[model samples]
Target: MSELNTGDSIEELKVTPDKYVPHRYAGATGDFNPIHIDPEFAKMVGLPGSILHGLYVMGLVAKTSAGAAGGDPRALKSLSVQFRGMSFPEQEITITGEVTGVEGDQVTVDVVAAQGDSQVIRNATAVLEIPPG
Candidate 1:
């Protein structure tokens, strides 16, 4: 493994959920929220359309963080995020992250999810344990 220093930039991960992403996630997670699976219902509720699950987006952030830390998912110790906006299917979501701190084996990162110009996940943070090589 390469040396990791504070202020190191993490590689960005981008995701473009297909139209059936919500349905697939709903089936996998048992979160059948209409806002995430029903376009008409979402529109009726004043949304542009069916929105992606917040947890799904968070999962993307988590995976991205793990990848940044040498692709070991177990290295991720903690993750927190604030869902600030809705994400619709077929929209490109980019996960941006930076190493904010490094203490011993712990690496703290500031992460966010962006949909075009919109910041969908705000105040996102992830802590990972990078194994020494």
Candidate 2:
């Protein structure tokens, strides 16, 4: 959004998922899956604990993309992210992106959201239209 060019890095976002994130998310989205809200159930099912919802993490990545695209949701053309690993609550996930291509009014950006050394979102890409100055 600010004189964007290929290889330019977007402002990174640091996200620390709260301990109550899963509970709040469940209350808000009506997705009360035990794997996301019931730690005991999750452990019984072989998960380390109640994991954050995948869509929640994806939405955060999208929000980061929107911020990079001039903070206007309309500038976004498309967004995609592959869920490569689980993201646990109370862990910090860093959202980072770099401009990959620019042609005409379209700009492509490669993005990743990682927790520690693990990638929670991979193959993340966003296409946006640069608003006329």
Candidate 3:
């Protein structure tokens, strides 16, 4: 939320096990496909582990971006992200993005997350409106 110059990128977010994602959120979001929680079910489909819910991924990205932009997450205008790679539990993850500048009162961000050298998520973006004076 600092006065970012056009094209300025924000610092990346460090993720951990508790934040590994999905969890009960899948159930809360009604996306309870065992692959996101059950190991056996995940293995049945060849997943590494119960992966985080796609929307949860977006939430993390959006919240982090909002914090970076110095804006309230509740005031966001639009937010979206595309699934790229599967995020595994216990793996260290990082989320990063850039400010594509502002549009009127809105701020734009392009973001993604990675584990080690592997990209676990991609095509992330967040749009938020600046607080009115």
Best by lDDT: 1
Q: What RMSD, rounded to one decimal, does every model reach?
A: 0.9, 1.0, 2.4
> Candidate 2's residue-wise lDDT over 1-133, tens digit each?
3878999998899989888999999999999999998999999999999998998988888888888876898988899889999989999989999999999888898999999999989899999888668
Predict model 1's lDDT versus the native: 0.91
Can you rank all candidates by lDDT, best first?
1, 2, 3
| Tens digit of per-residue lDDT, candidate 3, span 28-51 | 787877877787788888886677
When 2 and 3 are scored with TM-score, the better candidate is: 2
TM-score of each: 0.96, 0.95, 0.82
List the global CA lDDT of all models: 0.91, 0.89, 0.72
Summed over model 2, clashes come to: 0
Give the total clashing residue pairs for model 3: 3
TM-score-superior candidate, 1 or 3 = 1
Sorted on TM-score, best first, the list reads 1, 2, 3
Cα lDDT for residue 33, candidate 1 = 91
**Candidate 1 stretches greater than 4 Å from native:** none
